[model samples]
Target: MPVLLGGDANVYGMARSFFEAYGVHSVAVCKKALPALAHSRLVKTAVEHPRLEEDAVFTAVLQSLAKAHPDKTCLLVSCADGYTMQLARCREALAPYYRFACPAPEIVQSLGTKEGFAEVCAAHGLRTPQSVALPCGAPLPELPFGWPVIAKPADSPAYWNCRFPGKRKVYLANSAAELEEILAATAQGGYRGAMLLQEYIPGPNTALGVVNAYCARDGSVPWIVQGQVLLQERTPEGVGNYGAILTEPARQDTALLTALADLLRQSGWRGYANFDLKYTSGGEPVLFEMNPRQGRASYFCTAAGANLARPLVEDLVQQAAVTLPVLRPSVWYTAPWGVVRRFCPDKHLLGRAASLRRRGCGTCHLLAPGEGPARRAWYWLRQGAYWRKVFANG
Candidate 1:
């Protein structure tokens, strides 16, 4: 059985993937039971611990859980960045119990942040936006670029735990004053990590793209899936979160896929990787950042024929050969049709979502066919509430 870390959509999505590929009920461990995993029948167990974020607490809890399931081969995967870092750090101790693959600690530290990602891209000869890292609470350095730059946390894990008024995942500053104001507020809110100032790649929400790849031991990619983001979360903290994605054969770019694969091989990296990028007017994708773990919407790749759990179980547990196919057309949705229709800012992409919906191509990460009346009702209510939440916040 797989022991998933986190209670959000990533945990539930991976839990569902495990159950779908194998009939095993995966155990989910989170600080609190979020809606996605609360009433799901797929999860065999949900462990809630207050101190899971602490490195010592995380190591102790997972070690104990591994001991409990000694006879069974337990595979541990974390959805949150902090948890993923802990897993990599405690890999020596956890290795005896779990069967999983992750990047080295130094690699996780080097490639985990926006600043590090830019450096990595430079090493690999990949195109990325011009960026500068600003130390929090310090005078702004003279940027080689002009105003209308992008402002965001260079370290996501540190930023995730911080709560402050007017906090957003990313900020588009129109001038030096706006950028400085953002820096002041972020520092005042207790965010001490490096804040990045980048050249803004302007585009509609639909112009964003994502690439999900699973790298095997020999630096071979078992499968890679790329999709165009149709809509994104407008809420402050959820700003960068994708709400809908479109994957079709017509839009596939072979060169882009090869370039990313080369980066993985050159970096000597393994395990799942998720990348976010945006296209310039020249139609070139500018690398934004890389999430080390399978993203929260990892199921997006699963929908395009890359089952997240199957590869791990086959490669690690079954010790059998695995083959794959290229991705195909499909739509991945985090909410219901009603929610997407109402909240999607671009009407052109909204129409495509509608078309995909009619053909039964849309998949909801949180919705499953096995839910009973009450749980099912709760699921709909939870997703439907996004309409109110977005508008209210606006």
Candidate 2:
């Protein structure tokens, strides 16, 4: 019997590492067209609908996998919210055919939405940024806090919009007027979802991003790993642009991470998830946000030491008891060449290329040498061309 891992291709790095570590064969189902650089032999299947319609697509995909591999143990690990929620909803029908690594539908829903999760965090005394939600069409909330506050849609479009090819917008406002202006622009642009206006927490040069793995049945926190802060950059709108540099564990940060882990255990969250956080001036760690699915940094964790995906697969397929690894402090960096091209388009291409050459960080580009240079070149060229158009208009 074989194991099938299905979800967005964004998780290919982690998924691939896990499959290899466990010596298991699997397939990846991407919501969009298959990437040209994917492993030659990894089965690639395309969904009928885009990411927002992942629920419908995944239900169909699961049915197909079940029919195609009835003799095998199919483990569905959703790396996107739409797929996660959809899988939970169809748990009854799919459970009889395949194993799923997710919490119950109600539990997932409770943690999926910002409002719902915020309420839970408040009740549990977790430290989250000060937040105020405004009704649609209403004036923005009074700015009780000062400048450089972060504002974003409380409900991320990961489920509703997926990753559309465009200049994504997430805002950081230094004044109430700025916040109001951005909200107005967003409303005018037809965004009607609930949004959060939060106090932005600044920290030292180094901060930790914690990824925890837990057991769903007893809410047992099994693994807590901390990734070193390499470099963090944000768009003008305050959305995270690049995360580079992952290093060995920081003990102080891990204690704070463990505290949050205890909270998740009490809340009955299971399977896999991550929390983004920063330490305050007083050295208190404050919560930034929670990802109810596989964190984008999963690859960094796998590359650094522990393979998160392996346990997830084992838990789903064999209900196996697993222990986590004592991962050494290691360094990870996003592909410098890609980051420069992604964020610094105003500079000359030659200058950007030079800057990347000087950067010292882990290189994990979707397209790198010995893998598929031609395909990587094509994808970046397309991305560069798209950005060129935006800058030309500006």
Candidate 3:
């Protein structure tokens, strides 16, 4: 049995993966009722959880859950950064009875922070945009990067704790004054963490690339899938989310894959990890950041025939190394039709729709037949609000 955290699309995909492979339902614990898992029949439990930041409470709850299922081995799966951090920090204490996977605490600490990750990339000779970290309420210094810089949080989980109306994860500042204004406003919104000012890469959403992999406990990656993002859900809430991903047979960047794999091995990162990158004018991919677990759009890898949850369960629960075939080339859809059409102008968009019915091509959050009427109604209600928001933005 797999115990998943978070109720977003990532957890929904994870639940489906386990059910498809092992025929066992996964228990999804979340703080709020997210349509992605709440409306899915695959999830056995979608109960609320305690505040994960409270380390003691989180550890106790995990212990309690593990003790409840004495006959089964429960593999803990976390899809959010905050939850991952808590699990990593408490891994030693819970190691006696519970089973969860993640990188060591030192590795998590270094790679989890934006500034720390940038430094790690620099040490490994990986390309990254010129970035500077500023303290809250500090005057913006003259930056060496170009104008129209991008400002984001150094620590996403902490930043998310600070509330701001109409706040996008990343903001563009076209001038020094604008940068300072954004920084001041962020501080005023209760975010006192470091603000990262990054050089904006000039390109459309198509320039984005992602690499998803499953690292074993020994730091070996059994499989990896790389793809190019054709579209992104640009709604305020979906700014950094992948919309439609295309994984062509020959589109894998060998050099990028090798470098990223080395980074994971050297950092001693275990479990599932994904990298977000953007290509520059010269076609060089620069590291944007690394997610400690599978991304929200990680269904792209699963839809391509390489479900990540399988490897985690096999390696951790079965205690065996499993070799998986390379994923097939396919297009993964997770956005509203209107949003996908708005962002992707490719003539072949209509032709690619045929794959939706095939095994290797599918969606992360589409309501299908055989589902209960209550779940179907919930799907439509959520879908209506999502598309309404996207259309309202236009």
Estimate TM-scores for all models. 0.93, 0.80, 0.93
The digit string of per-residue lDDT tens for model 1 on 1-394 reads: 7999888888988988888878888888877777778678888789899878877887788889989987889988778777778888888888887887787888887776677778899987888888888877778888887768989888887887778999998998998889888998888898999998888888887789988777776667766778888878755666778888888777767788888888877776777788999988789889998888788888877776667888777767887655675566678988556766776768977787688768887788788668667778878787668766777887
State the TM-score for model 1. 0.93
Top-lDDT candidate index = 1
Query: 1 or 2, which is superior by TM-score?
Result: 1
Best by TM-score: 1
With a 3 Å backbone cut-off (N, CA, C), the pairs that clash in candidate 3 are: none
Candidate 3's C-alpha runs over 4 A off are 345-360, 364-370
In candidate 2, list every pair of residues with a backbone clash.
Answer: 170-237, 171-237, 245-332, 245-333, 246-332, 247-330, 248-329, 248-330
| CA lDDT scores, all candidates in order | 0.80, 0.59, 0.78
Q: Give the C-alpha miss distance for residue 6 in model 3, angstroms.
A: 1.8
Q: Cα lDDT for residue 294, model 1?
A: 84
Superposed model 2: Cα runs more than 4 Å off: 1-9, 23-26, 33-43, 50-57, 158-169, 233-238, 250-252, 337-370, 376-394
Candidate 1: which pairs clash? none
